[model samples]
Target: MLLGEELRLIAYNTAIKHNITTSMVHKGLYQLGVSGCPWKDADIVEALGDLGDYGVHNLFAVERIARISEVHPYSRVKGLLYHSYESLGVKERDENGEFIAPKLLWKENFFNRNERGEGNAP
Candidate 1:
């Protein structure tokens, strides 16, 4: 809450130094498009770029479920994190084999029986 303009300016300059743009930044205070799968094709750095575009500090702060759920309407914090990284704005690919808003990087939970159409009630 204390992110002064100086820090914002530093962040902006860092973004520019790293080649991030303005329109690409998302004001996630509104939590729009905060749903979907974390990308599976890019590395952590690329994923951080995408998160940066969303106005996240890239400090990798893993908030509690209650806190994150306040921002994202998801059941699990992990799910919300996945969705957050997956919702970045994408643009046409540049000539460096890197996507403007690169995809996320994570593993799929194929063994989660809950999502496999199973129930506990008899």
Candidate 2:
């Protein structure tokens, strides 16, 4: 499956298991500086950690998390994304060059990729 599809599945399953909205998962991801592109395993891990830090536990089964993690291994994606963002000279960072999380903007339709013709075949 495509990475985006995998991510959406993880997010959807996580939200369903936690009885929370998909926006909640997106909020957590946003807080972790995820920009919905070039995802890495670390991004997923950090996003999950952000949710856990906010007391959102048991979002998904351990087996599911493990499977996703195995599929998306931690690599240079974060650095690559950061580099691309930096090349644009965007000032979305602190003095330390660390990215600053953007404000939460919930877009409920983000989870409805199928209706939008952006979904992958199952």
Candidate 3:
């Protein structure tokens, strides 16, 4: 299989100009949440800045799962975690009221199902 970069090169391009550039679209598709390359939260913030009112819960989920997968023996975590956004200290927005992403914590507690369980760590 081609890597994210490779797939990106072959992806269809409308060549529209904006912060939501073709590159961002490609990255969103192939590299956003996986063991492809280093993707920063700032980039997500930039590409999705216009989507301020939009809830970014799904994107963070992929990011955290990928981070955990990178450390663990598998690429897909098979278990559930109990950590909440509050417990992980993840605020889903920046001070400017723009949408910020919650990153993954590399804690065993992130993967274990606690009595107060809610959802994934990110």
User: Which candidate tops TM-score?
Assistant: 2
Query: How close is each model in CA RMSD to the real structure?
Result: 15.7, 11.4, 14.4
Report the alpha-carbon TM-score of model 2 versus the true structure: 0.30
Model 2 per-residue lDDT at 60: 36
**Highest-lDDT candidate:** 2
Write one digit per residue (lDDT tens) for candidate 3, span 5-108: 55444332322323244544444434443334343433332333222223333344346534433433222223222244344444545689886543443335
Candidate with the larger TM-score of 2 and 3: 2
Per-residue CA lDDT of model 2 for 54-94, tens digit only, reads: 45443232222232323344353322221333453445568
Between candidates 1 and 3, name the one with more favorable lDDT: 3
Question: Order of candidates by TM-score, top first?
Answer: 2, 3, 1
User: In candidate 3, what residue range of length 10 has the lowest lDDT sum?
Assistant: 73-82
The Cα error of candidate 2 at residue 99, in Å, is: 20
Q: Can you give the TM-score per candidate against the true fold?
A: 0.23, 0.30, 0.24
